[model samples]
Target: MEERKKFTFSRRGFIRTSALAGGGILLGVNFLNACKESAQPPVNIANLNFKEFNAFIKIAENGYVTIFSPNPEIGQGVKTSMPMLIAEELDVPWEHVTVEQAGLDTENFTRQVAGGSQSIRHGWEPLRQTGAIAKQMLIQAAAARWEVEPYTCTASNGVITNQAGKQLGYGDVVNDAALLPVPENAVLKDPKDFKIIGKDAINVDVHKIVTGQPLYGLDYTAPGMKYASVLRPPAFGQTLKSFDASEAKKVGGVIDVLKFGDKVAVIANNTWAAMKGKHKLTAQWNDTTLESTEDHDAKLNAILNGSKFEVRREDGNVNSAFSEADSVIERTYESPFLPHNCMEPMNFYANVTAERIHLVGPIQTPAGTAKRIAHVLERDEKEIDLEMTRMGGGFGRRLYGDFAEEAALISNGAKLPIKVVFSREDDMAAGTYRPAIKYRIKAALKDGKVTAYHLKEAAINSNMYGLIPHFFPAGAIKNYKVETGNYQSNITTGAWRAPYTNFLAFAEQSFFDEIAKELAIDPVKLRMDLLDNVNDGEDERIEYSAARMKETIKLAAEKGNWGKAAENVYQGFAAYYSHNTHVAEVVDITLQNGFPKVEKVTVAVDCGIVVNPTGAINQVEGGVIDGIGHAMYGNFAFDNGKPKATNFDAYRLIRMNETPKVETYFVENNLSPTGLGEPGLPPAGGALANAITAATGKRMLTQPFIEHFNTDTREVRG
Candidate 1:
């Protein structure tokens, strides 16, 4: 049915309902197609009010629409995507919608965190129904004016058009739409008629980002805001024994040296002044908390060497296969701790008062900030207002509340607004790293078929312990066992890219390469057989799209020229399903004068429905290179409790000349949209390892493949 609403004129101006706040307000919108199947009704976009405050809004006389998105937009491009959903359902021109960075208003906010790539997928339906229901009320208002049936009126591009072609702009219909009862069930547009869903839209903030406009937390300078620098423990679990800030406070711009129980913060008028004050002082550290750069290397090696933990996966007996095997192969791989090192280092601004805390910054999870700040500040949850801003890059590093703690403490002590900035070195030295892992995969095959496989992985499982409670079975392996072991490394580890998949693919796909060698079969063909050949249509749940897995592998193999090769050039392939997206990739590498030089890569994915095909492809391309960076050279060695690689000068990243040409293809599917962000990362690591193994007949279990090349056999140069 065509839907419309009318506007009401008043001295305060006309009150008109809008389809703006990301598919209109979901507060008064819900499913019109509810059966016993639905749980709640849609919100009343026209007349409904925010549960807490009298914040109900209507379209202004000028036809502007405003909505507050609670989630932070870090460079992963949420501002544009979230806004797109709202504009699409509201039937408003995309240009007409204005998104307000939602302040922490729990009563009116949605999930408010942009992690696990759940932003778009989670908001799709609620936003749609909200827009549809709002459009309905607008149509009813126009129907009253035309003296005709409401079903004969349809709304498009903010205009209500009747069957007889009589049309009225939404400004003329909002007040009327507001008066009508919110429809019980509003019809939604089907996919065939969608004008915007799958189309490409330029990033809404591209101009601001390019112009170096103040967008990130670093640029957020409030009036009278003092810059602060905190001396956090070099490693986690270490408490501050004592500190001397007398020398620090003597710096020209240094205001005060505020002590906050565990750490001392030097505050000043400018960031440079704060940094100067910090370097001018010396502090004492507890003996137990202190370790020289070389002290812990032996202990770290011991922990990796002697492992014990729970079995994350198990299938047929590994002992039985080893007992009856004609040949057995075992290889161990190790990865060093890595820092996220997002372009914009960690920074946050917080103003803490006796009654409330107003914290704003480029944070990934505002809701998390609200809870943690409320508890730490000993204030009511309502008293804390968190504002999520555009993030430079989350990559899961921004989830930690350590920076929030610093801001809150500094603000509380100084009785003024405080913004804490972590210098590139501090962000690196004040640890949170990708946990170093030691993986040992053992395979037993006879008659060219794998009978038993055992993968023993050791790392601090602290980061992904929440998300992937159980790993390995998440992958499609028939006879697989994953033994997990944790070592108490002072270097705190957290979710980076695909988290466990980083190590899992390192071990899983590396084992596959060895199994392929033992069986003398193509690696791509072997994985395809594992997914499709062993898969049933419905009976057994593999937790992955086996069919899609097969298709992606087949597609990438063809594009990568699987059956052909050039002198010194070899191809490696890997497939993984994570964050609900199935991805397969092939890396082309060659033993160039000996070191593995990546030439090009071809990747294919089945990510349900591509929300924005270009974005999806770009994300896949970026993720693959990111994974490649980790595989080829991404690492920060931990010596003792401190980082050996503190800067890009020491820690390496893949440069343009080293970056291969990435071609990504999306597998056609009729399924709903899943996430496109993290799924593309896992396969690249394994693909590079497999490609390297193919180029040089060695089971490369370790990371960076650098140590393997710098082995006793010979050294490889770039």
Candidate 2:
């Protein structure tokens, strides 16, 4: 057999060789050397004058076009939708374009992240410009050969035709085009003329996924790699004091026991050996002053009842409005801390040497991980190469780079390339949970209308990021005041899916439903009246689109047949705006043997513009199911500073049989797309809770509703 040729590029960051099999002209753009943070401002791809834009396009001699997508794909379908933008502006047929996931090269790609649902919002213009620039160069090359003015030539479906009727395929002129100067200006196609965007497109890697191909971080491998499992402190706020690893070293295939900080790692030749070795090790922890759940709850409630707190948002005089009210409604809603439970668990691969560190895994923040690794290993940011792999599930758990950093430290300590894997128990018990919160809301109504509202929220760790001030209904109410109290803890907390809005929407929207019933008014109409009174011009203050919210609510109600459910079915409505996307959900639920069961859900979304309709619908459907699962039975409690549910055996998850039918629809518009990942999630829990109240005369104030109903007996529990 002959030796295979290598793939090489020039020092200028452009690849100009036919080294690739099946001859083609490839164009690759390099990214600027910037800071290692994913939150960068959007780039305008219409102007090619920018010094850095790292994207790739290849015009194969066989007429096939290949584009490299530069964002990490965590099942959000950016790999498919992003390429459609490029192919559309290139004036190429969608069927002839191929998309591939690019590696993490900060010098060639910026903000390669998977969280925040920002990939489509930011990549839209830059990727399109990459294709348009390539198309311009090809047209110029063809015009130079035909000896005609470039303006007289028009390109369509990979072919350029002149006024004289002479045609040239892009593959024929790509060689000459590679030598031409990069154009400073490239005109974009009109939205009406778009052939690929806003249309349904299949995921590029669907075939590999269904055929049992290895695409996730857990399935990654490298030469002479060792597997390791770490034994972290059994509980938070504890430190390792001593360890006995003699028995672990005696285990078959066990290589060594490495100690780093408060954790000890068992390294072996394979995963099973590493796990078995880890189980045999015995470690003692110190300062195990365990805190109880009851203590934390008491502290949070005390803060909520006290007057000392930070003022997040305050409007008109709430005290005077409450004093003048005809009636007052008050309730306190609470949620427990929840874990991410990402399907594949947490695993990372790191190869460290004297020169540099190489890391790869399914992390949401690649740039942040690089920065963390550089800081930990005392190496330059450029010395670390971070490659992103498809994640099994993110849900904001992968946003932290602790796993990657730990892997790098272990690799350096062990003097070998190491793959650190977390067992299901380890991952579930690890903290970084969604902060548990308590909300005490009071609404004063006069003349059958809400006049004043006050919300006092108590939370563990940090409070919501501008949730109390910027969330909707703030401007809708005349007299509104928001206050928050916080109690710090050793347990780590961070973003989980929709973050604070996940439970906040459930609490606030459910309260609105209660108010409508007490006032003897239709719940949908009550919200609509509030929206009518809301001034859309104050968008800067409220930070939400009132028009879009109203549209989605109206559309969802119409499609779900709100207030006109069939026999044994009752409908509940809720709408919320978050992550720059507006979403409304109507749930149809029925009681079976005194237990509420969700039958169906109809969702209306206004994410401005839908890039891939199929992908957007999938996101909405999945979010609805996820929301239902959490509302029905998603929770984890702490006892003696340790999680009670260490794995799925104790903790529960929604199964296929329990999933409700979800129907999704989008509002048509020409605005730039926002995000679909987290917005669809916030309102779903609230709608389901409202439907439960409709089906059963009792309201389930607490989440995971499992405490009130028995699954086997289908009876209300005392």
Candidate 3:
């Protein structure tokens, strides 16, 4: 008999084996704090005679495998996709796998963020290795019972088989397997032998979504939980001066009215009561110094032409290159502040006690929010339990902790569990918006080739983050310079989807189209020509994969039937690299009446190994729709320092009838997977703009292009 090695898990609830219905093995895990560097299992799962493994996997006696996905599912499908990584290496039939959503538990999980599309990218190797370790332990247990060498046993579809034709189900040996020590290292399956990854898999929540299950933050409820609505200062720089809640107190179902600096809240038995109470309350604000939208726009424009600016990236002498070039093209682009109008408006439930606080919500960053809540409550971080619910849409808006903090404050003051909900108007009026920006690009062309490029971006709050000097065209051109200018404002700005790339791609990629036209070269050929000079090496400064970038561009062009549109249909193309992913998009658009109507979109992405092709494609399609909606009609304005677009009546989104037919393709590669969440979005706007330009022979220099066109007349209104 083989000698068994004993191992113990260090986390709070590492491995706890229990009997399931019928005869089966049930395993649960908690993450080990020490095992952050590799994919090694922290505790042995095969030691079931007396002990077991940690939080993720649970194998049943009947051969069903349950995997826990520990991340927020904000319509991007990480819940269904991450578990596939583990199921693939465990060699189990995909049909036998069931996925569960895990609550926020830091001691058992690490890096549980859902933004930047990094869930799969970060969990790829470690998650697969975990499944491999579990499979090996089960194989060893089966081998011990059969009196055979472990190396001679093979496991497939949750069962182990030996060369002599003896077979045992994983459930049959899980108890003894739980007694054996875990393998120090397990070999990951080769890509060619993969049965799950890169294949189509439906979202784990699809059934619940279709059935109208309670999975969103707005649907969350707790015992004795009261709904609360807040009346915040209307303007960015304003504060509450005075309020009269006399009439609000008479509203039916109204429980209590509380006041916090700069805001007032009405707590009631239900949502409608709270909303009515808030509407009835009379309030006045001190808006003496509030700045209007025009003020901010003028400041940004002044900074763009001003001399005070910081150079972020400079290579070779751009001045000299321009002086020596045959022609220099300069154009400016602007994008306005836009809101993240999530289908489910901002809402959070918080229960506060003297000892601890419980927070549940649809947030993008739970850990960060927990820390902020702890600070606000003056409690230790460990005392707060932050649980994330499925978000209708995050789009980088939930990253802020303001809403969660408000809920905590209300709960603490009321001494009860309270759910803070924002109506459509409130969410739009108070949310942090994407920063408006001005981009000026100058390209020096010599003999039909881009020799030098310069870019200066000016913004009201702050410049784009992660925008390095060596961004795209950095290595493609000899002389490059990137500069930034800043103007101060009271408007709160935060990340929106792809962040800077959302607007930057529209500016840079569309400018490239202009350069291509000036040089009388096909846009595709111009891009490929520029890419020819890019070095494909292990350079840290190279933000984009030259090979992969070229691949996506060629693939998108081919799949889109580039330059083959009919007389009335025009095709425009744009490619971009962000979040370690390369994406190329081609838009087929036609002028309907006076407005550009997007007919179809073709996208090619290279984000390394795609874990779930179906989910990946869904993300691409949704991102394209989001991009087009914002570019066509999404814009927020301010008058007297108050948000103008406070509801759907003023804020418009892409309807189903207007959404284009989107087709997505992926390049096959053996590299580790990256994020697809935000990459597909950055180039969509640029491609649509390019297509519009092609159709009308006019360039859209400012975003929310709907504002500049007369839809009924088919002419420019600007």
Candidate 4:
């Protein structure tokens, strides 16, 4: 036999393997993989072997592979798509691969976050390398058995074949492969050879979701766990004075009531009893500095017109360009604070004891939440164990783990295991809403060409980040300026969906259409002309790829039949670059009973490589629908520091019958993937707005277009 080299392994290496009890191999990457026996379903961890090891892939006695996806499954489809990257490189048939959601393991995984649509973008390479290394080890094991060079031996479909026609299944040699030295580097497959990636794969949890199995946070439970319904401050800028819980204590199934800072928690045997007991309580609040929507509106408007402004970005001389211009077109757009309104209400389970703390819930930031909990409880981080359940829907809501912290605190206070559940009213009324904002866009038109561009943003709490100022149309305009101002308020606000770009894209793209109309140029042509001014690599600040953006624009225009709409059919165009992805959209609408009825939306995206076409399409369609629904009807406000709407009965959402058909096309490329979850959303609103304008000669300068144009009746609301 060839001299075999003895090697020692370190945790930092890309691949780690160990022999299983029943003559199999357990392999893990820095990202980790699944390790489950064949006797149980991949998700059923009750009988999991190698529990202490943070491994991902496990080749059992049979030729089966299980991959544990480390990121949270916030309906982004990473539970299915992340494994495809590994199975493709492993040369295993997709049918033989089983995927399971992995828990938080700080030792093996990095960037386990699910926000920013980065799960796939970040896992694209390392996940593939993991499988490639495993496949290389298996091939080497087979080569050593057959006394042939590893290069001559080939692995395919869970089997290795040597040059002399000797063959062995991965399961037959997995024990032997476990002893082989892991390769420092393994060759990756070419894009042309991809089998599972770029192909359609159904969601791994579809069966569980459709059958209403226990997968979401709402379905989680623990032995002897009591339910909690918390009553927070009734309104913004309010503090709790006192509560009379005597009547609440008398309610059936009510156990006990505990008062925490600024809130009261009702503990009961079940959620219904907890809620009932909470409703029976009488609480007094001290409301100072009570604010209203009108106040916010005035404050934002004042900031826009005020001289005090922080210039985010400036190029050339905006004053000189504006002063010398022939005409200046300025328009202001406004948006209201909105709630996430996830399908499942917020819920978390916590068990705090003298020895350790156990937490389970749907949280986007697991490690950060755990750390925060440790800080709050004055406990060591090692004593806390958190388990993430599948979320019904996040949309940036679960990014804040206030609910989890509440569960932990309530459990610690009650001295028992507790599950904190929020009612729909509680979910909406006390949500960390999307900050209300207003944008004032101005353009200096000189001799039929745009000379300068300026944008001013006034928001509720904070302004847009530095990256927004460097997005599209930055390098294209010679004299461009971006300014922002904010009014700090007591109401809490944070990231919602795509954050700044969600509304910014609408304002900027709609302004572009207005510019096209003023110049009497085709909307598509105007955008193309502006893009022609942007030179690639000339400015490092420009994050958008002009070449890629132009391709998407051209594709959307062609597919949408931009200028060839039939009579009575109105078309609108908008394009945006955000989340490192370029997207172009065209909305088509027709007058139905004198009201614009959205017919279809054509979208073209350049997100580099498409991981799973089915999941990608689903994400695109969901984003477009979400964008249209929110832009048309989503609205929230506060009256005297109290939320105006608390439930869907008062709030409005898009009806299924009113949803438009979304057609998506991708510009295929072999480059690394970018974001997908939020990119498709930003442009849909602007496209719909421009299309409505084309159908009816009205400019939409505010969100919840229903406020300006009534969808129920044929007349304008104003």
**367-467: candidate 1 lDDT, tens digit per residue:** 77778877877888878877667888778888786897789989998999999999999988885677777766687777777767776656654425622
| Candidate 4 or 2, higher lDDT | 4
User: Each candidate's root-mean-square deviation in Å?
Assistant: 5.6, 6.5, 4.3, 4.6
lDDT of 2 by residue, 345-364 (tens): 89999999988788889988
- Using lDDT as the yardstick, the better of models 1 and 3 is 3
Better of 1 and 3 by TM-score: 3
Candidate 4: Cα lDDT at 575: 96
- Rank list by TM-score: 4, 3, 2, 1
Better of 3 and 4 by lDDT: 4
Clashing pairs for model 4 are 33-55, 33-56, 33-57, 34-56, 34-68
Per-residue C-alpha lDDT of model 3 across residues 1-718, encoded as one tens digit per residue: 2233233333233343444334455544433231233223434334442211224787877778988666778888888888888899888999898887666654434566778887787777667766777888899989999898999999988889999998899878877876776566677887878899989988888888899998999999999999999999888888899999999989999999999768899999999999999999999887766877798888888988898888988878999999999999999999989988888999999999988799998988887888888887889887887777899998888988799999999999999799999999988989888988889999999977899999998986665453556668878888989998877677888899998889899999999999999999999999998998888774467789788899999999999999998889999999999888999999999888757889999999999998888889888888888888888888888887788889988887778899999999898888889988889898999999999899888898999878778766877664
What stretches of model 1 exceed 4 Å from their correct place? 1-64, 107-110, 235-238, 289-307, 461-478, 536-541, 566-568, 710-718
Going through the candidates in order, what is the number of backbone clashes in each? 30, 1, 18, 5
Per-candidate TM vs. native? 0.88, 0.93, 0.93, 0.95
Q: Indicate the worst ten consecutive residues by lDDT in candidate 1.
A: 30-39
lDDT of 4 at 204: 87
Model 4, 579-676: lDDT tens digits are 89999999999887777778999999999999999999999889999988899899999999899999999999999988999999999888899889
Score candidate 3 by lDDT.
0.83
Model 2 is weakest, by summed lDDT over 10 consecutive residues, at: 32-41
Model 3 root-mean-square deviation: 4.3
| Global fold similarity of model 4 (TM-score) | 0.95
